[model samples]
Target chain A: MRISDKYRYLGIKLTPQRLAILSYLDGNRSHPSAEDIYRSVRKEFPTMSVSTVYNTLDVLKEKGDVQELTIDPRKKRYGPVNTPHNHLMCNKCRHIVDINKEFKFTLPSSMTEGFELTGNHVEFFGFCSNCRKKQ
Target chain B: MRISDKYRYLGIKLTPQRLAILSYLDGNRSHPSAEDIYRSVRKEFPTMSVSTVYNTLDVLKEKGDVQELTIDPRKKRYGPVNTPHNHLMCNKCRHIVDINKEFKFTLPSSMTEGFELTGNHVEFFGFCSNCRKKQ
Candidate 1:
């Protein structure tokens, strides 16, 4: 997918700062947090503030061009994958990998008894290969 | 469920503080954060600190008596429900309700390609009645 086109389609101004952030997130599967993004992009834009990174992520999330992951308690992570998917997190190393599989199970009638289900995200947690190797 | 027995079986010390926290979580559907728990418990034990609440929660989580919810971006919420379940959160008010229904979906092979499946949590987001009314 063309990152540039996605930003334009979302009506976001293609500023150098935003473009830099977008380029970093393009095809990024590591699910980096705001700090990670800031540190990485700051290397290119030395004067970029952490708040700007957060702002860009917020805008991207609002535009549905990215997903904010709350699976980790310490920090908020972001994923550039815009499709319906699930996550597998390594409990030991804190690495997050995407699980591209689809599950056909419907929400139990009892669970959805009252509220209307709008969207769902399924998350799986376990140790990754690297973490397992360390053990 | 008997809070007393639950604690005893879990081998956790039945301190007055722990009991107070457990009572607060019992039958609680409005998922509360650590700060919420500290505030509520502090009404009786004014000396209680936030760290204590977090420590108790960490212990409870390890024993599988409580579940830590990461669906909210601002803070971590806790649930007393021990069974497998899903959550429905209000996007506007941030109210979280329990969905007790069971879904019989198996993960698609492609999604689980190589990683071992351990556990899953499904989260649903939308506006609750109060927020809907306001809108």
Candidate 2:
């Protein structure tokens, strides 16, 4: 998708760096961190700073256009918002696989005893087929 | 529990600073971060360092004696491992409440198509009762 058009839809500023960041994230399932995005986008814009990538990501996250995943506690990973889904992280390789299927869960009364319900995310940790084969 | 005894169970070194950290973490449900623990433990052991807190947490985490939570994207929170459960974070107050109940969720075949599932966690984000009342 065109960067300017994406900015219009996301109601964000159309900066060259922001466009590059968004373009890199568009349909990206790798769930990259700020450093990952910075390294990839730097190939095109050598002058772009890591902070720019982080700032753009922060804006995208605040706008709900990008999802920040915590599957890996060491660093925050970003995923595209094209589809709403959970994630499965391979323990061996640390590769995050998108779980596109939605699972209905009836929260036990004890779990939601005193709070209003909002949004919930399920993170599954496992070994991918390739990783399992190595094991 | 006695710090030395706790260390014995955890198979960790029984140092004074380690004792202080373990004492602070024992039965702690607030899920404090490394900075939080450092500030609290530093009061008793004025010579304690932030690196000590992080190192101790890392050791405890590796041993499965503590659970590291990523409910907050900014920092890693530590919780006692007395029980296994999910978490609910209050968006307004940024308070993390423990949901001590097992939830049964059946992942659709497509979600686990190429992965060998190990475990999963449900992170619920919303406003707590107090926050909801204020809102």
Candidate 3:
């Protein structure tokens, strides 16, 4: 596969496996876990080990090319760094859907204490349609 | 210390170690990790082990007596389950401050995708005064 010019801009070494990982992540909204990436990419590069996926992800994370999310407690998930958005997650199944709108709100200074305030994210937790049906 | 009457309401057998863990978590907003609880509680119960803390936390989680938070990804943090609230965390220190106000939000159907939304929590990420000083 041809390496994208964007990978060049990231200033990381682009091995075949790294290129493959980056290609997989590009525009991937599934918010795949590392294991998910490893399982899918290994179909092409049979020699690809899980470690390679993690190492490439670490490099990309350092370059600010991707975001690592702890939205799911049992495992970490990755998504493209994009316009500021929040997530809605299934409390039972951990399914995630991106909410693209931005929220505008202010916190009481009493609650914030003396911390220098910054950006905020909202996480909506509930049963997804499928999980709700199972209930 | 007296075993508080609240523990009985949960209907779990409370061993001394379990009680110690419960006492540590009671009204505690520090969001202590299992390891943090083990280290502190062991100072009192010489035989208290880390696994015991984890097991007690698991039981408490099952009983819905305490909340398990993934706010700090490296380990699970515990917090009191009280009135609806949110958190502000320092990105550098991973310190959390409770935001005790509820946000009223409604999601557009296109964004929700048939999710049976239950609740939402807002997380504000920023540099705390201590971390800002170091920066």
Model 3 lDDT, residue B92, Cα: 58
Write out the backbone clash pairs for model 2.
Answer: none
Tens digit of per-residue lDDT, candidate 3, span A1-135: 233565665454678887788788888877789999999999999999999888888766544455666677778777665535488877556677888888878877777778776667788866688766643
Task: Report the CA-based lDDT of candidate 2 relative to the real structure.
Answer: 0.71
lDDT of 1 by residue, B57-129 (tens): 8766544456676778888888774444577776445577776654434556665545444456777654465
The C-alpha TM-scores of every prediction are 0.71, 0.65, 0.65
Which regions in candidate 1 have their CA more than 4 angstroms from the true location?
Answer: A1-11, A83-85, A88-100, A104-119, A125-135, B1-11, B83-85, B88-100, B104-119, B125-135
* CAPRI tier for the interface of model 3: acceptable
lDDT of 3 by residue, B58-111 (tens): 766544455667677677887655535478887556788878788878998888
What candidate 2 gets wrong by more than 4 Å, as runs, is: A1-11, A14-16, A82-102, A106-120, A124-135, B1-11, B14-16, B82-120, B125-135
Q: B33, model 1: CA deviation in Å?
A: 0.8
Better of 1 and 3 by DockQ: 3
DockQ by candidate, in order: 0.34, 0.37, 0.43
Task: Write model 2 residue lDDT over B7-122, tens digit each, in one string.
Answer: 67656686787667767888887778899999999999898889988887766554445566667878888776544547876645557777777665657767675887666677
True contacts kept of 2: 0.63
Question: Model 1, A1-135: lDDT tens per residue?
Answer: 565676676566869988788789878877789999999999999999999999888766554456676668788888764445567765445566776665445556565534444456777754455544432
